[model samples]
Target: MRISLDGQVALVTGAGRGLGRAIALALAGAGAEVVSVARTPADLNSLREEGGALIRPMVADVLDASFYAQVEALERLDILVNNAGGNKPMPMVDVDDETLDRLLALNIRSVYKTAQAAARRMVAQGSGVIVNMSSQMGRVGSPRRTVYCLSKHAVEGLTKAMAVELAPNGVRVVSVAPTFVLTPMTEPMFANPDFSAFVMDRIPMKKLASVEDVANAVVFLASPAAGLITGESLAIDGGWTAQ
Candidate 1:
């Protein structure tokens, strides 16, 4: 089925690069006007050039109060992709307080605040879609991803709770949980043969998901095609979590 988001406005956090960049482009390609947020001016400028007029580049940290002010200034927000987050792989015993706080701030706190800001506009308009970026790690544990898993699992719970509370207001909340996707940021991690082999063995499809894979899911979920899909996670994990 063909999905179109013409006339809709989408805001994608972390859109300057990697999966978020792919998602922002995909949304614009699907006919939505996209506001791309990121910390680097150069990256946002690059995206603006590539994405053309449909892309509005916003250089701001998602965790900043100024970011929320910018979001509040938008006339309308039809879709919100909470894609700004990171992972620090370290043994559970090696997890430090600072690392844990940082991950939680970015992965959970920022997501919640961003979604809350968008939800207000959406609720007033009486329709909107919020797609929280999650990870397969959210559903299953890994040896060196204790903090990453914790933050994502919290995102999973947040998605559901937000969905339940906002459904009556015509706002939808969902999550896109992807497996280790092949991106510039992640390609280096696979340089280790042991790590690469371990990951390859776990994925039944024997390959990492591409940025396009995750982007496609986000676009579909934000479109009318996924109208009834809320409070749920679409795993683009190449059968890894299915194992």
Candidate 2:
């Protein structure tokens, strides 16, 4: 069966690159008008050039107050992809307060706030879908990603809570938890043979998930095909968390 988002409006955070970019393009390809958000003007411009007229590039940081205001001002929001986040891998002992604060602000706080703004609009209209970008790290622990894992775990919990609270309003909340997908951000991390080995060894499939893998899941979750799915995380992990 074909999934279509025709006549829908979607907002994707961090859409200038990686999985976010792929998701925005996919949603547009499915006939949705996509507003792509990112802090880098260059990246957003490039994205717009690549994704064409259906993609509206918005240069804004998800952590900024203005971002929420902008979201509130949207004519209508049918889908929200909370995909802007960061991670600094370090051992638990080396994780400093700055790193913890940064990760928390970017990962959980911004996600919650963005969803709140979009949900308000969706609730008023009595329909919408929220796709929070989580990670396999959210589902399971890792050696040097304590804070990253913490923030994502919070996201998982937030998804369930929001789904329950918003269901009555006809707004669905869910998360897409992907294994390490090779992207500009992760290419350097995987460049390390040891790190690559560590990741590959954990995945039963012995390969990383692709950007399309994660994007397809987000689109499906946002589409009517997943009407009954909410408060759950769809893992595109290549079975990494299964172990």
Candidate 3:
């Protein structure tokens, strides 16, 4: 089915490359005029080159609360995708306070702050949808991912909290949690056979999720078809945590 957003405007964080880029394009392709924000100017330029008229690339660090406060300066945004986040391998024992701070700031805190900013605007409009990008790691724990897990677990919690509050104001909050999706950011992991095997070991499907797989879910949740859905984290993982 075609999900239409013809007169809507979408704001997607981290929209320069990787899964964020894919989602931005998908939203635009479905008819929403996209405001693609990212920290990398080169990535934003590439988005404009690739998506042409459908995407309006904005280079800004979403973690910078100041930028998000002014995001309303753009056309009234109807859809907000809190897709910006970063991760690295680190065992909990060796991770220092600074490391934890950075990880939380980039992954979890950014989602909350940005989503809150968008929610404020959405409430004013009396209609809006926000989709946060989370990781399946948020659901299950693994070695060397304690901090990452913590951040995503917070995402799930915040999604629930924000959803209930936002629902009353005509704004819905939700999340998409996926396994290791194949993207430029994860290409390095896929290059190593050991890493590849390790990741596939948990997935009953055995194949890494494609960027499109996650993008499809984002589009659906953003559409009117999912009107009744909110305060939920949709898992697109290939049954990885089912066991």
Best by lDDT: 1
Candidate 3 structure quality by residue, lDDT tens digits, 1-243: 889989899999989889999999999989999999988888888888888898988878977878777676555989999999888788778999888889889998788888878888888889999999988988999888899898999999999999998898888889999999887678987899887888989899988889999999999999999999999999988999788
TM-score to true structure, per model: 0.98, 0.98, 0.96
User: What's model 2's TM-score?
Assistant: 0.98
**lDDT (0 to 1) per candidate:** 0.94, 0.93, 0.89
In model 2, what is the error at residue 199, expressed in angstroms? 0.9
Q: Output the worst ten-in-a-row residue range by lDDT, candidate 1.
A: 65-74
**Comparison by lDDT, 1 against 2, better one:** 1
TM-score of model 3 relative to the true fold?
A: 0.96
lDDT of 1 by residue, 1-243 (tens): 667999999999999999999999999999999999999999999998988899999889998988987887789999999999998999999989999999999999999999999998999899999999999999999999999999999999999999999999999999999999999999998999999999999999888999999999999999998999899999998899997
- The C-alpha local distance difference test score for the whole of candidate 1 amounts to 0.94
Query: Which residue runs does candidate 2 get wrong by more than 4 Å?
Result: none
The stretch of ten residues in a row with the least summed lDDT in candidate 3 is 66-75
Worst 10 residues of 2 by lDDT: 234-243
